[model samples]
Target chain A: MRIACPFCGPRGSEEYTYLGDATVRRPEGDAPSEAWFAYVYLRDNPAGRHRELWYHGAGCRSWLVVERDMRSHDILSVAPARDMALARGRAA
Target chain B: MLAEKYSIVSVVAQALRGQRGWKPVWREPEPRAEYDVVIVGGGGHGLATAWYLASQHGITSVAVLEKGYLGSGNVGRNTTIVRSNYLLPGNIPFYEHSLKLWEGLERDINYNAMVSQRGVLNLFHSDAQRDAYARRGNAMRLHGVDAELLDRDAVRRLYPFFDYDNARFPIQGGLLQPRGGTVRHDAVAWGYARAADRRGVDLIQNCEVTGIRVEGGRAVGVETGRGVIRARKIGLACAGNSSRVAAMAGLRLPIESHVLQAFVSEGIKPLVDGVVTFGAGHFYMSQSDKGGLVFGGDIDGYNSYAQRGNLPVVEDVCEGGMALMPGIGRLRLLRQWGGLMDMSMDGSPIIDRTPVEGLYLNAGWCYGGFKATPASGWCFAHLIARDAPHPVATAFRLDRFATGHLIDEKGAGAQPNLH
Candidate 1:
């Protein structure tokens, strides 16, 4: 599978490290144990159209959120995860 | 009714009678309206759970609902290796129990699973790797599991064809377990299914579980393709589909499904007598009874529900194979298959009750699900019947991750793909 990285254009999957389920939200430090547990452990491993986190180790070293179809393995969209986080007002 | 005994006498008698007296090994039963216990996923683990439930606990009114046919899951797709040479305290006893179960599984089920106790050799390269093997072997011995440390010459005497002189990764020594070997993967499913069916457990095929019906925080039944079949307790052994199936009960699991592929070469003369694994790379190989080299490497480092893999993994696996054994490069690759592995955060399994009442889980097997089938079923049956974790599987609880008791066997931390 080839991922069209925002910074590196297109690259093979071997160049990137997979971090599953980009939708997970880390809870605040003062949050309850259940919230932290859900954040740390729980995942929605859907069959199609999954947004996942990937780290480009061999290229631009940028963290990306690649929207790919899990069933067909087709990459639909790729953007910098940091940029997406900032757009979502998640960055500190 | 007396179960058919497969023996040479029966074979000869059937041959004399034009081979017409043979009966079907298992009955294809229609799903009943309700069952005492329902096991979703009719793979090896599910069927074996039903068998153990009947034989050990006398729970005869059980039903195993399969989304597809039996043996269609990882049970039929694995590289058919059985070993208990583990290094961790949390995993050693559990797999040792499974290995012991595999030793007597044929006699217990009265089926020829062809459980070959040849051996398993983990080849080590550098001095550091040799020490690691030594430590692992010693740990296995501490757990009362048989393990032998082999020198470099010892491995060469057993298999002289390895690329030992390669400068990148020179072969030094190995860890050998004589009792650890291979079993016929599909026959295990068939054997367990027939045994469970003989005990009046319903083997319902093509019965996809669409939802888990939880009533008042307790699992009451399942909404399947056939219909809503009620059960007193439900066990989820759906493997890669564990997350999706558990979600129906409003429960989220710490699992990500990844595809792990296996390959088999065209029929040739016997090359590998037992299971052999390379130390430097992710390559393990064995010769099938059909004279084909059956092998597999690492799992595709991506979360996927698809039962297929991309080309990169294939190329990487072939490279590992060539790096270890150059002679295999000339052989034609005959078939390749992928099985979805339920990779846990700590790379261990969870066979325990969920927070929801009457709901049991047996999943997060990673790539070691096939070898753990017997003990997993036995322990899962114990948990379901008694409402507690089995003695050996005490550490494999769903709450372990929450309690910071992760059994990181490979020391790979929380990364499921790394484990």
Candidate 2:
């Protein structure tokens, strides 16, 4: 698995730390219990490529936007979480 | 695979017996003469490295030595959370792979450690932050991953306690890493130790290395508590104690020891079911399986192996968690303990081919130690067994500082990442 961070170079996965999946939208207060449940406990566990968050705790300590294959452990791309959303419109 | 029925008692019992249903692998001392590889520190990284070296690469004659119990150091003291939402490219892919390994570890390593895919949300405040999450989410999607930028409404809906509507530090949004979750910190280390031991790796406990014997700029063997153990190759998996060990071989590293603390509240009705953070909130919290609200705040400002933090951090952490989830104000704090963090000059770890030969390192993890255990071993094994830099670790070269290619993550100062 290889991630291309905006700041750091291509480091082994060990340098960066795993945060989790990327699509979970934070629910506003007073949302339904189901929204809270989905937000807290539910996960897609998709088999194809997935978006995830990672921190380069060992490296830059910045949040990373990583695209990875659930089934194959193949990384599609890696970047800072800050830039990931805007780049969301344009798939690299 | 772990039995569906599990608890700390069951886990500890099995570990003490070394599993095959009996034959306790308890502290029975065994004399060993030699091995193919000798790895110091029985923490997760050491055990994992031994596992990869033996199982993945077929290098079976190996030994892992621990000064205390496996994970006795910083590994066990961490707040276990696995994540790959990084700001660096070189590291994202590897951790993503580690996340993949985590998903299958129960089966692959035959350890029932729950790799719960609890989501993690890093909240934001300003438009700049929203854009950051957006970019990160997009990058995740581009790399075939899943991430999305949430709006204020989305954030409020996800975390009801957050005061998104507040005028100050208005809830702009956040970056959610759902694949992230926690694991029993000790189990991860024991799991690797168990698997590696079964694969014919010698795991010597309480065998503290007093000195690293080097010859001709090559690490030759180690002087242990009992006696000197000779080996052709060696690895330093001592995260918190790395600077001391590396110094034994006359290698100077820019690692500083910083104390980190975590607190657990009295068992109570579950409030927060998953991990959530408000960088603005100054705290993060998640209820464990038993309903104890377990969490921690940022790294302690100073250095020490005191195993206790200053009163300021305790107040700061509680205040932060309370601010994020005002509902937990009544929950009593059960205990708080601190661990040493080997903070590197470049917040990123140094896994380079150091000036000394036959020596490899997997330190400088800061607060992310527990999460990156697997990937650290895999990459370190590559560096040790193959004598070449794994593509991702090439950026962590020893000369990065001298060359001014620091990969800085400490936004407060110099490049934490050696660029």
Candidate 3:
């Protein structure tokens, strides 16, 4: 699988580190156990198009939100995670 | 027709009769309305659970639902290495119990599961690692499990073909468990399935569970691709898909799915006698009866439901293999495949009751599921039948994480990939 990093062009998956589902939001400091558990462990494992975080450790060292298909290894889109977070009015 | 018992006399008679007096190992049953216990996923753990539930608890009204064919999941995908060398208090007893069960599995199930007790060797490269292994070996001895701390010369005499003089990560010593070895991965599933079937448990294949039905905070039934099948008790033994299936009942588990790849090299003369793990890297290799070198390394440090892995892990594994056994580099790569691992928070498994009544969980087996098959099945059956945790599995509670009672076996903390 190749990820088109925002900083580095299409690079092999070896150059990046995969952090699971980009959709999970960390719970508040005093949230209940359920909230924390969900944030830490729950995953949808969607078969179709999904968003995930990949760290380009070898090249530009930038965090990217890669939209790829789970069923088929097809990269749909890629953008900086910070930009995606700010666009959604959330903290990076 | 009933399956015939396999024996030398029966085999000779079948040979004399043109070898046609055989029956299907297990019946392919159609879905029934309800059962006393319904186990989701027809892998090794699920089949073993059903077998124990009937043989021990006399709960014969059980159904094992499989999304695919039996033994097509991780049960058949692992590297087939079995061992009981563990350090933690929660894991040593459980795995030791599993090793004992593996020792008697073939006779107990009346099947030739190809259980070879050759032993397992974990090499140490540095002085610090030797000390750590010494501690673990002592812990195993304390638990009455066999463990031997081999010195550098002891290891050299046993396997002199290793890269002993490697400038980096030179050979120091190892921890040996004579009872640790390998088993026929697919045969285990078939043996358990046949035993469970003989005890009147329905073995349903190609039946995918779509949703879990909960009524008044209790699991009552499941909606599958076939139809609605009700059950008094349900067990979620779907290793990689634990999170997805548990979500059907509005429950979230502390599991993340990651792909782990295993590889085999071209058949050659028997090389390694037992399982050997590289101390410097995440590579381990053992020879199969067919002469193929069966081995695997770390899980692809990512969350993936896919059964295929990227090239990076492939390269990394090959490098580790060559570093340990350079002669294998000349062998041709025959085939490689991946299995989704149900990685847990602290690297330990969970075999406890879920929050929803009548629903039990048996998952979070990062790298130890195959070795834990028999014990996992026995303890899970106990939990389902008695509605209480077994004595050995008391620490694998679902609420442990909430109470900060995590069993960090590898000290990997909360990262699933690290485990």
Candidate 4:
């Protein structure tokens, strides 16, 4: 699998490290324990069309939000995770 | 009709009768309208659960529903190595129970599963790894499970072919479990299916559960591709697709499905005597009775429902294999396949009732489900029949994630891929 990193262009998947579920947002410090638990443990784990976090550690060293199909391992889109977070009004 | 008992006498009699007297290993039965219990996924665990429910719990009115044919899932896709060498108080007893069940499985089911107790050796490279393995071995011995800490010379005596002088990770010592070994993976499914069928449990194939029917917050039945089938109780042994199936019941699990690949080399003369694992790397290998070397390394380290893996993991596994045993670099890989692992947050399994009424869950096995097949069924049967977690499986509660009682065996907290 090759990830077309927005900054590094196309790179082999070996250059990137996988972290899961870019959709999961960190809860507030004062959030309820149940809310924190869900944020930490629960997952939709969809079979297709997953947006996940990947770090281009070997090349550009940029964190990317990769939209890929879980069923086919097909990369649909890639964007800088910081830009995506800022666009969603999440503190970068 | 009940299946005939398998014995030497029966084998000779069948041979004399031109093998025509032999019946189908299991009957192809139509789904009943209702059953006392319904088990999803006709893999090893599902079939074993059906058999135990009928034989041990006296719940013969059971049905095991499979979307595909029996053994089509991870049951047949694993490397087939079975061992109970585990750490942690919560895990050792449960896996030890599974190992003991594996010991008596062939006789109990009257099937030759080829349960070979050759031994499983985990080789350590560094002094720290040796101390860690010694601790794990002590834990296993304390639980009455067989474990031996072998010195480097002892490991060399067992298998002299290892790269003992590798510069980066030289072999120093190892941990040996004498009772752990491999079984015929496909026969496990067939044997359990036959035993369950003889006990009057319906083994329904090509039955896809599309929706789980619930009434007033109580699970009543399931809407299948064939038709709706009701049951007083439901058990989800569908590890690969656990998240999707549980969603039909309005539940989300702490599971991420990842692809784990296994490979077999071209048939060669028997070389490796038992299972040998590289502690520094994730590679483990054993020679099958067919003379093929069966081996695997880590999972692909990503969330994927695809029953295939990337080339990078293949390269990584081969590199590890070459580093440990350079001689195997010449062997040609004949076949490689992937199985979906239900990686739970804690790196352990969950075998308890869901919040939904009349529903039980047996999933989150990660990549270790094959060895736990028998006890998984045993505990899941106990839970569905008695509405309580089996003694050994109490730590696998569904609410443990919420309650912060997670059984993180690898100490890799909340990271499913790392586990």
In terms of TM-score, which candidate is strongest?
A: 4
**Model 1's CAPRI class?**
medium
lDDT of each: 0.93, 0.73, 0.91, 0.94
Predicted model with the maximum lDDT: 4
Per-residue lDDT value at B93 in model 4: 92
Interface RMSD of each candidate, angstroms, one decimal: 1.1, 20.4, 2.2, 0.6
lDDT of 2 by residue, A17-54 (tens): 65555777778899976576455433343335677788
Q: B293-363, model 2: which lDDT tens digit per residue?
A: 88998765433445566566787798777666667787888988988777666677777667788887777
**lDDT per residue, candidate 3, B1-419, as tens digits?**
45777788888999999988777888888889999999999999999999999999999999999999988999999999899999999989999999999999988998999999999999999999999999999999999999999998999898999988788988898999999999999999999999999898999998999999999999999999989999999999999889889989997777778889999999999879999999999999999999999999999887777888889999999999888888888999999999989998888999999989999999999978999999999999999999998899999988887778999978877788888
> What digit string (tens of lDDT, one per residue) describes model 4 on residues B1-419?
88899999999999999999988878898999999899999999999999999989999999999999988999999999899999988899999999999999999999999999999999999999989999999999999999999998999999999999999999998999999999999999999999999999999999999999989889999999989999999999999899999999999999999999999999999999999999888999999999999999999999998899989999989998999999999999999999999999999999999989998899999999999999999999999999988999889988999998988878989999999
Ranking by DockQ: 4, 1, 3, 2
Q: Tell me which of candidates 1 and 4 scores higher on DockQ.
A: 4
Comparing 2 and 3 on DockQ, the stronger one: 3
Off by over 4 Å in 2: A1-92, B1-31, B415-419
TM-score of chain A of 4: 0.95
Query: Using Cα atoms with residue i matched to residue i, what is each candidate's TM-score against the true structure?
Result: 0.97, 0.75, 0.97, 0.99
> Alpha-carbon error at A12 in model 2, in Å?
41
Candidate 4 C-alpha error for residue B191, in Å: 0.4
Please report how far candidate 4 places residue B175 from its true position, in Å. 0.4
**Against the true structure, candidate 4 has what lDDT?**
0.94
